[model samples]
Target chain A: MTPSHSGPSDRLEASLAGFDVPAARPPDFPTADVSYAVDDTPIGRMLLACDGSGVLVASLFTPDAAAEEAALQRLAARISPRVLRRPQSLDEARRWLESYLDGGRPGAAPAWALSLATPFQIPVLTTLAARVGYGDRATYGQLASWAGRPQAARAVGTALGGNPLCVVLPCHRVVGASGSLTGYAGGLAAKRYLLELESTSL
Target chain B: MTLPPFQLLVDAHWRDVARLAHALVGPDDGDDVAQQAWLQAWAAYPSLTSATNLRGWLFTVTYRCATDAHRGRGRRPVPVEDPSLAAAERPAVDPPATASDESGVWQIVATLPPRQREAVALRYVADLDHAAIAAALGTSTAMSRRLVSDALGSLRKALS
Candidate 1:
């Protein structure tokens, strides 16, 4: 512990150095359960989560690193007990996301699997995903009607708020009955960006 | 209060875990140990109560995985038949850390008892403080400090 003339510990530190910690690699877990990766886009960082079946969740990342991590962790724990950082696992999701951003319609409707949620939410989300095409907007009430629940506009909003597949499922297209921009999980600004991105198609 | 997500935990200590794995097991086996630790941590993540101890918990998992591989080598059939396993054991081809003055220190430390080597590696290689080291080793802080001190003493003598 004494600061001598560059003693044994210092010598050891100097010599056994340059471990060249490799560029961070996606972790490969024993069984391919759940994997996640972050993609940087014009909007900001997007966190994508997936399982063996298909892409599960996509959300605008929180700026705060710790908070973002916790949010993803909670999602993974609830959705898939085993989660890891494997960007390669999300290759397809990344492709679709990039295409969508580039004003290209996703080459195909993405394969998707939803985590556990309310029964009512499933039909509402499914109808929204199918009907709300890019550059298109639907009122919450209309979405409710499409799902065969004409009086459940508010519930439809609630379901959209908890949407696991935000951009991918087109949740941002849902608006208020008056055509007013409404609440979005990615925030109202992001909603505007998406709407503009689709409308202008530049 | 909700705990920080597993992704954050992995980012924070992944490098440390990787280095510790390399120190305990050689390069090839070290990578395997770290990957296994990530899987195990994810499975056990929900059950974790104190979020503050995430580093310690992860390191503990990494340590266990490394030890398991060590034990496996002694008991199981020589994995040398597998190309990857054979590649892992080939030190001349796969030198992870470059040889230097400190390299001798590791060579010396390798000769010590397992616990002491672990103590030294966690302290020096992983750069964990005594408390974190103790937590990872599943021992009291005092014990961890003593182990590190003893290991250093031995290292100094070996160098002399």
Candidate 2:
């Protein structure tokens, strides 16, 4: 694949653009500079995994390596247990993620090339990618309509709620029907900051 | 011989349980898996004298709990109806890169079906050894290796 025209990377980038981890993200998040990327939300920390070419996985407050692994397992089930220190690939991703946390934006805006298994998730994520505008918010009902199922407002909310990529998927941008902010795995405060960043950027 | 040691073991490996459980189930459902594993571990802790594979033991409990949980629940309907995956919202454009470079690799990885992804993530990303991986996945070592090797070969072909 010469990279799908609007590959999955764009979906991830659009989703996470505004929501960096909080300023007090996590002092122990394998790095320190991102420790201050604070936001007001349920999520205490954020983890962004990029292969330099594009982001792969972005998790919020996954906690630690254990948490990271858990997230990875959820992403890829039925694991093998080989302990090789050097994996021969992914160095670029490691650097990209480091730069993302170190408060530096990537130098390039590349396309993603990961295979997504979920059928409904891609379009839902695509919608999320487009709606991300820092602090801007959209309602589940609205997203439901966008996904071609206006009656599935609740279902939309549930899907957004389960989004694993947190900031990367920009699920934080979705709110309640009554204009109230609903649940956020990374918390509401973080959501607010993401909206703020996007709002101000525009 | 005391509850404290068992408690310590549970606490020490609690995170691993959570990780494996969460991977097996969603993060929300992972709590249940962890809880069951701890109960099982506590019951088995008195005789768990050798300290070598404590992590593996705990993980196995978690993985089994998750599998049982899933089996008990029958199976989740595939194509889990969620429109928000595409319809949710996007963040404002930023300079930071959040894309990826593993379409070929993970596409094949994804093809391993879901169970294998869970095992691979637990094994490689979690740095869990074979025993731990098997324990966490609730499968035998041979099975775990087969899935992994199959996934790896798939990834290589995808990349190539």
Candidate 3:
């Protein structure tokens, strides 16, 4: 039997693309129809998904193990078949994703529409993104300090751990003060590798 | 019986979310992202009107949770279980690329810290742009870029 590539994009594109209309179906709530692609990065192949939302979910080297499970649970927790709409922009979205996978950096974003509701989280995220460097690392306590809630180190950890967006946010940059990589949502090994990369290159 | 909206949404995005959890926080952190994301989804359930696109909503919630978890907030500690190596109903694996010259990629990646691994995987494997990567790993675009860069550096050195 031919191995199924990780997703239906190729087949879907071939079959569905010919028609201007997508395999349009009434939205399935408890069961949103999902589509995704993979972005090959210098480190590994990342799984890029566009659920019914215009926003993308990128699971880095997500593998077939625990990471995949976590992504599903996260999706379950956010919205349902009752509320959000499935992707109205499949062709545009798929093309955009293909662009990124092909390493055309500008094409990483969807050309048509996206409605991400993460305004409430910009402050802490902004600081982490701006202040951290490629190889450098920060501590959870420091992140709390930056957020002006110095005592909330663990709380910050919670936020990082729950980040719906994974690599794009750089939560891995934060660590424990002991210079020990602690509590990386990805895992300690990934954390160590990040810092190691930073120290060596950036 | 119709699957609960939450279950269906959860089921569809399960693999993606689990991959995010494993790549960013470590296998240990999956529960936290999944639980808090669920809690957030449940809390915001009332606001949902269209079911056509629940995937983004779930990603946002868990992305927020992951960010919070990274910052030392909103973690739900659960019992740890050894990885079964093979789950009963996992997505079928791709046929191995026996000919790709860049072999043992995961092996080297596995050697990095969990955070770095997450960054690396999210960027390299998942192919998320900095924005989506930041959301899952709970950081920002530049920071996310750096993490991936550094991870690549480690791999480069190790492979050398």
Error of 2 at B148 (Å): 36
Worst 10 residues of 3 chain A by lDDT: A16-25
- Alpha-carbon error at B3 in model 3, in Å? 6.0
Per-residue lDDT tens digits of candidate 2, residues A12-124? 32322222212111001111111111122233544443332333433446655676445444333311111111222334444543453344434432233223225666667
Candidate 3 lDDT by residue in tens digits, A151-199? 8788777777765445556687887788766676556766565556556
Rank list by lDDT: 1, 3, 2
Docking class of 2: incorrect
Against the hidden true structure, what lDDT does model 1 obtain?
0.70
> 2 or 3: which has the higher lDDT?
3
TM-score of chain A of 1: 0.78
Distance from true location, Cα of A112 in model 3, Å: 14
Instruction: For residue B142, give model 1's deviation from the true position in Å.
Output: 8.2
Candidates' C-alpha lDDT = 0.70, 0.49, 0.51
- TM-score versus the correct structure, for each prediction: 0.69, 0.37, 0.37
Identify the runs in model 2 with alpha carbons over 4 angstroms from their true place: A1-43, A50-55, A64-66, A76-110, A113-117, A131-135, B1-160
Residue A20, model 1: Cα distance from true site in angstroms: 8.8
* lDDT tens digits, residue span B33-147, model 2: 6677766765565455565767766666666677677667774312212212322222222221221222323223334445565565566434566665666555677766665
DockQ for candidate 1: 0.23
Error of 1 at A165 (Å): 1.8
Candidate 1 clash pair list = A15-B102, A16-B102, A70-B5
Which one wins on DockQ?
1
